[model samples]
Target chain A: MEILETALMQRALIAAVLVGVIAPAVGIYLVQRRQALMGDGIGHVAMTGVGLGFLLSASPVWMATLVAIVGSIAMELIRAYGRTRGDIALAMLFYGGMAGGVLLINLSPTGSNANLSSYLFGSLSTVSEGDLDAIWVLAALVVLVTVGLRRQLFAVSQDEEFARVTGLPVRALNLLVAVTAAVTVTVAMRVVGLLLVSALMVVPVAAAQQITRSFAVTFVLSVVIGTAVTLAGTVTSYYQDVPPGATIVLLAIGVFLVLTVLATPLARRRARALRPERDEHPAAEADGPAVPAMRGPADEARV
Target chain B: MTTTQTESAGQDTNGAKDATTPTVLSLRGATATLGSRPVLRGIDVSLRRGEVVALLGANGSGKSTAVRSVIGQVPLTSGEVTLFGTPLRRFRDWARVGYVPQRTTAASGVPATVREVVSSGRLARTGLLRWPSKADRAAVQRAIDLVGLTDRAKDAVGALSGGQHQRVLIARALAAEPELLIMDEPMAGVDLASQEILAATLRDQVAAGTTVLLVLHELGPLEPLIDRAVVLRDGCVMHDGPPPKAVGQHALPGHDPELLTNQSCHPHAAGEPHRTGLLT
Candidate 1:
């Protein structure tokens, strides 16, 4: 309670909660599209932006957001147009961004490995007032896009070709996803760190899906799981002097493992409930003999 | 003289048969290449209202490519496609069209219930950004029921069998209530039960005057609903009328005894086994 009274602790908790919500909200779509590692790429690109911020003596959070957006859009373009050479293009972007950050930070007058390490792995105590304001604005934007356009985003992520045929502006929506994911990376940068932001984005969704049957349930449950783990990890770190980012990610992975173990029994129970219907018609279960009775009505219906 | 000239040009493009029933889709000299290999070489296909046309071919015969070109999925290198009399490039009325691309499973990267996937079909009709109305919900439910997956509507699609997964895909397309349904290989690996349900569903759509263009490996159960069969042999129309005599006989009157007696043997009614059984 005393720690919560401090301005620094309050700032850290607010940032943690926002990261918990926004990361998995955007991450669900990425996981849906099977591009879970896309967050990791954006995180890498944001490092260059952070380094540029140090060199210019500007806010690292906003700078990382700008560069990550450009990098993510480039990744989306390469994915859309350069099918054969996409992986190679992404590899170059990821490594180039990482190398650029190290080079730029060292060249800066005031920057050092210690300063970079805080951004790389996250420093809750270092969340300045300006960073908080930026995070709040950015997080609001992420929430608006992810929640407001859920149906459209769901359609696009589920099947791009079908979404195009539905006249859903699949290309624009895809770019929007890339851009939103980049924004989320910067939003989580201060609390979860640039290097580990992706775990918060992906792990919670993956864990929730272990027992869920539908996307909506998976989404709501993941957000709940994310917020819980983040708050718990932050509090635990406050007490134990552990890194909040590492603690939060470890908690998420722990949740995933527990859910996975629980899912098997849950699934078996579901199968057992469905067994009676199969038992009622044993012939249908057997792939061999075509039930002549079923075919007769089908023909009559056609006539 | 200019008015008559334009009218004659329209007639020339649409052909004489299109006068009675308006063309739902038409492709003229639709040439498409996949990575330098000519997949569609001067292919042409036309479907009129209420027509249930099947595009049939052996593997690599460009049947899939021709349909893909019709839907504007694959760009034509040098040709034109018209959907419901409007050129594909200008045709924005996508709500009138429902597409079911060939896929063995309806399961995506994420676990989605049968209802969730089917609801996406109604998006074309509901438009983007609008919440689904009560009517939209009913339509989605009806589509799931049409494919006989009402019970499984709430269940994850990943848990479904292959045939049931195919049914979910068909159900998704049906939710749009599109005037024109374009399905590529709707019956590739479906089981007998799903095949019957799909056939019945297609039959109902045809009776309601929904124009259909499907790419199929074999007619199988849908043999009865097909009004015309366009056989493609290496990117060219080899035959396009009356469901081809050799294939039609197996499905129509002459093969009832063999079909009934060897029902187990002919699991896929008019499949390869039936053809081989005929020769034996």
Candidate 2:
């Protein structure tokens, strides 16, 4: 009861909810672009910032977000280099950032007593009102960028090549993606910690995608799931006397597993509900187009 | 969009029954090298207003690259691409140049409706800070109607079939209300009926004063739609005329006559664009 009454727990809960807003909002692009690993990379890099802050005795969120932005840019730049796949590049940064953080911390070693386990694993009892205020500010920035550029982001996410041809500033859009990832990972670092932050962004959005083809639905459902998980996990962790971030991530995983099991039937029912629009199996047949070769060179002139 | 040559072309097209003015799209001495490999060489071709020009090239013939270069996606190694009567660099947004990229699958996979896809075409003209105007909305509706996708306006593009998706892209290009519409391989992977639908839509756009430029493989499917053919080989123009005459043993000028040999040793070796797909 005292824990519930404590000022710190209330602040942490507030912070978690505030940060939760970012996951589903930004996750719309991150999940679809299959850049779930980008969040993972950003999280690892955020850890380095946390370690650096501990060594220098500065604020962790500030330092973590700075490293996170750099790491996000690095991830994008490396992924664009040659045939290096995005996942491979992310993993490189993920491990490299972790190593770099450890090295930086060891070198400075200002606070040998600072327990990194809580930072890596997360601590709901640690958030201050000031921390929550800062999280809200970051969350608001994310909301603005997402709303202002949602259309372009949607168009780009759907087809980056087509987006480029249509004169979208694809390079700028790519940079925005990295920026959003950095922001989300940094804020989320407090709620879900470094290890499971990507899951908070990706899982709910992916679950939302499976339920509907509408971009709006995917987005809305992700927010609902994110909010729900953040709330439920915080309450449950408070009552159960466990680590908040780990419990919340595990709860999210459970939700994902259940959603996956329920998806096919729900999808079929929804499709069947609109039977006239979806003619039997026609929609299914039309789903995936094979990589078709060009038709024979024709005599057709450019019209 | 401020090019000095467009009014002349417009007046010329309006003069007769579907009379085309002079060429607005012209590429000369074009060369492309990707990853240290030559893809195009010394290309020279021009597309006239009211002309539905089919870019025919065997696979690896650099047809897509040629089209991409025309719209400024691919930079020329040593060539000039003129739009409306001036150089491409002079234009700001190239608002008059609408493009449907070669990545059709990517275009169609976006979780949007046909109408939304068409609305994206207006985005270039809309720029960043502004939403689509009523005029833009009407144009989108018109483009969707033109593509005969009004029935499926609300359906997810991902739910569309091969041919329907192509129509969606074409409708998107049309929404820009551009004079020059560049679509890459609009006919690939589509069913016969869908191809027929696309061909009909292309004809409509052309009739409505839009110059259609596309990369095409099978001439037979698009025979009814194309107005002329331009062949590219090794980044150079091989033939420029009607499709039937475009195919022949004649090679591009300024290159060795033997550059037309069917050897992979010189993939970009100048020759006719009809060297078949780069299946080799």
Candidate 3:
């Protein structure tokens, strides 16, 4: 209660709640697309933006946002157009961003290695008035855009090829999602740091997915789980004298583990209930071509 | 089945229908490449309004690519594609078209009820930043009923069988109420019962005058509904005429012995015994 009275703690709490709401909103689509790791890639790339900001004597949060957006878009392009496999392209951006950040910090006279560690592992003490303002503005942008394009985003994430055929402007929507994800990574970095931002984005959504049947319900539930874990983790960190970022992530993981444990039986029951009537219709099942076994001459020749 | 054939044949010769109908889709010398290999090499195919055409071919013969090119999924390296007389690049009336992709096991990983998935099909028609209207809801319900999945509409699609899942996809496409419906291998992994349901559903669509372009491995239950068949061989249109009546025979004119010999070396040729009963 004493810690809650302080302005710094209150600011941190507000930021945490904001991130908790925004990160997983964006994360649901990322998880749906099986691109959960994309958040991590963008977060790593954001470090370079932070380094660049320090070098340019600018606000690191905004710089990180700019760099993250560019990096994310570039990642989308690379995934689409690169000669290499999609994951390989993402790997390139992930490592390159981290390496570039390290090199830039070392080279910049203003960037002290000592201070850089604070950004690496978040320090709640550093959430100044300006940082809070930036977080709110950026968080609002991300949330609004996500809400505004929810249907299109959902359609694209569900089936990109189908979305394109429907004339949903698939490429533009994809870019919008990439940019939103990048913004989410940058905003979340203030509390969780780049190292653990993706955990906040993915874990809650994953937990929500296990229990919820509909995307809308899953989305709303993820925010609830994320906010609860973040607030509880913040309070625990204050009492235990530990890093809030790591505590928040660990708490999320703890909640996830608990949910998984509880969900096992429920999942089993649901699977049993939903299992197709294979026994009753063995002939029909056997009549349909087994997709894997339907390999044509081209596949056979290759083997 | 005989009734379906007679109806399709009658519709085909109805000179009054030809005079009033317009071309819904046209692919003129469309050429495309996937990674350096030419997948669609100078193909020409067209569909008239309310016509049900099947794009058929052996695997690697460019049937999928041709349909993909029409839908703008495959970038054409040369030639032109037009949707309702509008150039592909300039066409923006997407609500007028519905597409069902080939079924894959990769379920979006996000659990959605059948109703919700079907409703997404109406997104284009619903437009952006607005809640669905009464009409939209009614259309979605109608589509669900069309596919005979009204009872399961609230169930998560992940819980459905492969056949039911395919029906949900078809229902989704139907929700749009588009004039043109294009599907890629809609029955590839679907059970016979599901295929019959799909055939009946498509029969209704044909009766309602919807244009359809389907890519299929074999005609199967859909043979009776098809008014025309376009066969592709090595990225070229080998035949464009009546649907082949023989189930297991690749009986197109100018059959290449070399291609047949090459295809025979591969384990699953086009004329396998298992493919017969599904169609005939």
Candidate 4:
């Protein structure tokens, strides 16, 4: 509790909490769409924005957000329209973004690889008041879009073709997702670092799904897990002299492992509970057509 | 507002001449290409109100492409598509239409309950921005009941078998209570019991006067409900009349090898462009 007296710890804690709530909130949709790695790609692109901020003497947070949004939109366009070689196009964009940041930061008057490292690996203690303000505003927008339109986003992420037939603005919604993800990348850049931002986005959701049976529960539980791990990691970093970003991501993975271990027994119990219902239907055997009812005892023994 | 367009288009397709039954979906001279190869070459398909139309074809025959084009999933290179007398580009009342894509499983990367998946179908009626109302929830429940998935509504969709998974998709489509239902390969790879459940569900929907357009490999149990069949071969319509009769259970799809090659019921030549200038 004595750490609460320090303004630096207070700022780090606030940023950590914001990261906890919104990262998984946005990441759930990404996971649902099977684009879990998309957050990682956006993180790569945001580095160029951070470098541009240093080169232009502007706030890196805001600059990173703007550049990430543009980069993500380009990624979305490639996803929507690229015929073949889409992976190659995406690979180029990702590495180009990373390379662009390294080159630009070196050319800047006040920036070097040292300045860029802060954003790449996070610097919670170095979070300025201006950076805090921008993080708040950007975090608010992410929450609004993620929570306000959960149903529509859920529908689109669940099935793009079905959403289109429902007369949803599929292309527009996709662009919005890209933009939201970009914003999320920047919001997390300060606390989780660019490299590990995606871990916060994806790991918590994956961990929650192991024990959860439905999307709504998974959504709520993942946010809970994200918030818990981030707060714990931030506080641990305060005392243990470790990087908050790495600590937080490691904690999320730990939760995933624990859940995975627990899920096996839970699933078996569930199967036992549903066994009678399954026995009555016997639809599980329907997929196999090769085995005839008149199969010999030899075949049964061999199997 | 679109009555004049309907009358003109209706007159052009002789089967839709009856003034009482309005054309729900009309596609004329619809040409579409997938990659560099043409998937649909000038096909005409029209469905009247309350009609159960089946789009039948072998692999790569463009039946799936035709239905996908109708739902605006597959863009047409040159064609006219009208839904409920309104041209596709101008038609915005999507609440009247429901679509079930050809999918082997309804499970996504994340877990979702049967009710959560089905509730999404109500989005057409609720619009994209608004939350579901009480009426919307009731409608969703009714849809699940209609598909006989009420017991499994709260269960995760990933736990369901193939047939039950299809049932969830059908229930999702029915949630909107749409006037028109478009399904692609609704019965592909489904077990016998699930197929029977799906047929019964479709039977109820048809009796309730919901217009249906489905793509199927063959006329199976749904043969009794099908009012017409538009069979495609190599991106062209080969037959557009009563369902080609199956000689017996042996002639059912996947059982009879001769069914795919047989052309006795096809009156039109394959690959010939449809000359009926009726704009969709």
Candidate 5:
């Protein structure tokens, strides 16, 4: 209660909540597309944006957003036309971005390495009023775009070729996702830091997936899980005197591991119950008349 | 000479509908190259309304590429593609077209349920920023029932077998109730029982007057529903006529003898080299 009374702690908590909500909304698409690591890649690129901002004496948050958007679009373009496999291109961006950021930080005469470290691991005092404003604006944009194009994004993520064939603007939608992801990484960096931002993006979604079957449910559950973890972690870190970024990420990972462990046996039980009926009427289960008279024993099973 | 022959041949099989029904899909001199290799060379194909046309060929024979070209997945270097009488570049009425891509062994890793995946097929019809209407939901339910996966509507698609997954994809396509349905290898890995179910599903679609363009290896259960078959070899159209009569009863015009013998053994052969020449 005392920790929540401080203005600095209040700002950090608000930033955390905003990041928690939007990160997983974007992360769900990345996870579905099997590009979960893209979050990490964009986070690293945002560091370069921050370094560039310091060099030019501009707002680091806005600079990081601009750079991350360009970087995300670059990643998409490179993945589309790059001679090598997609992962290789992503790796190139990830390491290239970090190295560039480090070089820029060292070259800037006004800022020290300590400033970079705050972004790497996050500091409760680093989220200024301007940074919070930027985060809110960007978070709202990401949420709006994602919700507006949810179906198209889901279709493309499910099957790219099929989506294209059905006349969905696959390329433009992909660019939109990439741009949103870039913004998410940049905004999240203020709360979770560049290095740990991806944990906020991916871990909550992973945990949500273990319990939810439909995309919409998974999306909503991810946001709830992310928000709870961020709030709890930030408040606990304020009292315990630990880095809030590390606390938040660790909490997300802990939740994921627990859900994964619990889901295994539950899945096995459902499979076991369905196996007998599946064996007896494989044809009827697969392609028999619509709406079979009898249902599987595990019909009531929930994920 | 081949052009004249194919045109006349196509007319022979498409006689009834060819005259009155306008062409829903037409690929003229369509040529596409994939990574320096020409996949579809001067390919020409036309599908009329309410007709079910199958694109058949061996592996790497451009059967898949041809269909991909029609859908604008594969860019044509030199050719034209017209959909519903409009050039492909200007055509935007996507709700009228449904596509089911070839199945991939790699899982999408997204745990979407059968109903959820089927509902996505109605996305084009639902449009942007809008929830599914009562009609959209009804169409999705109808599609699931048609595929006989009503019981698994709430189940995750990952739990389904290969054959069942194929059926789910078919149901997704059917949910749109498109005027033109294009499927690439719908029966490649499907079991015989599921294939029969798909055949029945196609029979209903054909009766309901849905124009279909399918890429297949051989005509198994769907043989009866096919009004015409277009055979591809390498990157060119080889034969365009009625579905080859029951494998061995009569040889297709340009088919090789050895390929015909192998077809008897592998009745549902999909893109296999030996079955390519057994078009008849």
Candidate 6:
């Protein structure tokens, strides 16, 4: 067999499967919270952590994790300050995280070198066994917390106002989302690199959402999609002499585009098929046109 | 009274033969000041089980604050608010009270569907650290169906129309089958159809002996549906009986006569759903 024995290849495959399993699992929840872009922001923010480690000659992942968790908490705190207007909070944190990362890189003397690219774009060859261990630990932690706290997450994610009124402890849930985001960023740092990490966070989950309606199903499917992309990219990179990070991203994008396009036609057909159901009840009676407070882009905004 | 004033004693018009026995919620000398600005003050209101109470107030008249305080969203500056005979401060299990805040917009932006959002109604009763039981799931489905939102239950709430969106919120509240359903403004910004559906659904809840306390800016539309009305102005109860008596001089002692006659408070601006965030 040509694949006799090699540590890099073996490690890459193991890392790929592990990263694939965890990234999208957590990404699904993050995306639903509209914190998908947050991954990119967080990855960029993590540069300071990476730079701090690089400067002090410490573990880059440790430095990145600390800085990232602190930054993520700050981001959440700022968003909560919006007083029922939290959308502004999300954008402020997202862009602010990205900006911070850039500044950190600028101060690093090795800024001109490929250090940023290696971390930002991700280096598959650098996925050491130690990094895999962290990914495993993070993945396990994510599953436990997500399952254990699913109710709290659902309550807050669906309706913070009602949740707050009901006394569901929303502040704690908000903090959880942030802390999880920090964990995802830390684990993602080694496998996917910081630059493209956000895409990894959003694309698979978003792609999964188009096909599924339920949150639980969407979450599971996202992990499946993430695994596929990781495997496809890893294999293609090895055989095609392609850059691993770019290859993985491209593979993920390809899958997302195909699924999105395919889902549109299928959904349309189902809607057209619902004409008989519509005719059964007069539009004004069962489907009576009360004030249209339910659907529409305009209504969502004021809501 | 600047305008015509009138008075009436406790009148029973509903068919709840023995409804005057036990009260489900009570508020006494309650005042809520959001940063020195009193949202509600000197309020004295109580409801017996099966009472369909409507709260009416002018814009910024503390109607919302009153509903919020009973649910413990805002701390009472003074006085006491109780649910199910237990004071709010000591009332640990709020699960029995299914509250729909006046502002559904508070949760409008989350990326959840009509069904998922509705399922949240059972959060308090579902226990914090456990998965929902089969009954929980059924309750969620029943609530969605009750609100006539089964078709769009799978659609992202962000993708739904306005009226359907309100149904989702209603569904969320109904899922818990709360003994006391405290709604901020269930009919606000909703289409006439959604309102009608909600009214119908609420009627069923009434039949089942569920008490509802909701805030409203206007009573013109929901007039026929409500059993009683309580009007508040400047943090104090102006009128506490029924909608008919809570206007003009009968609107309570402290209410500003100018507000009811001239200023349109039923559908105020704050209740209007403004385009809120950067989600798009």
lDDT winner: 4
lDDT of 1 by residue, B61-87 (tens): 689989878777899998899999999
- The whole-model C-alpha lDDT of candidate 5 against the native structure comes to 0.83
- Model 1: which residue pairs collide? none
User: Tens-digit lDDT track for model 2 on A70-176?
Assistant: 88888777765537376676777789889877777767757442556666777777877778888888998898888788878877777666677667787788888
Candidate 3, lDDT over the whole model: 0.83
| RMSD of model 3 against the true structure | 7.1
DockQ of each: 0.56, 0.34, 0.57, 0.70, 0.55, 0.34
Residue lDDT tens for model 4, A213-271: 89899999999999999999999998998999999999999999999999988987777
**How does candidate 2 fare on TM-score?**
0.84
Identify the runs in model 6 with alpha carbons over 4 angstroms from their true place.
Answer: A1-5, A82-113, A275-303, B1-23, B33-38, B75-80, B102-114, B148-161, B191-193, B220-225, B245-280
What total of clashing residue pairs does each candidate reach?
A: 0, 28, 0, 0, 0, 25
Q: Which pairs of residues have clashing backbones in candidate 5? A: none
Chain B global fold similarity (TM-score) for predicted model 3 against the true chain B: 0.84
True lDDT of residue B90, candidate 5: 93
Model 4 chain B: worst 10 consecutive residues (lDDT sum): B1-10
Candidates in order have lDDT scores of 0.84, 0.73, 0.83, 0.86, 0.83, 0.72
Candidate 4: where is the Cα deviation over 4 Å? A279-303, B1-19, B247-280
Best by DockQ: 4
Model 6, residue A27: C-alpha shift (Å): 2.9
lDDT tens per residue, model 5, A54-157: 89998777888898999999998887667758777788788888998888988888777899998888876778887788878999999998887888899889
RMSD of 5: 8.2
Alpha carbon lDDT of residue A273, candidate 6?
Answer: 74
Q: What docking grade does candidate 3 earn?
A: medium
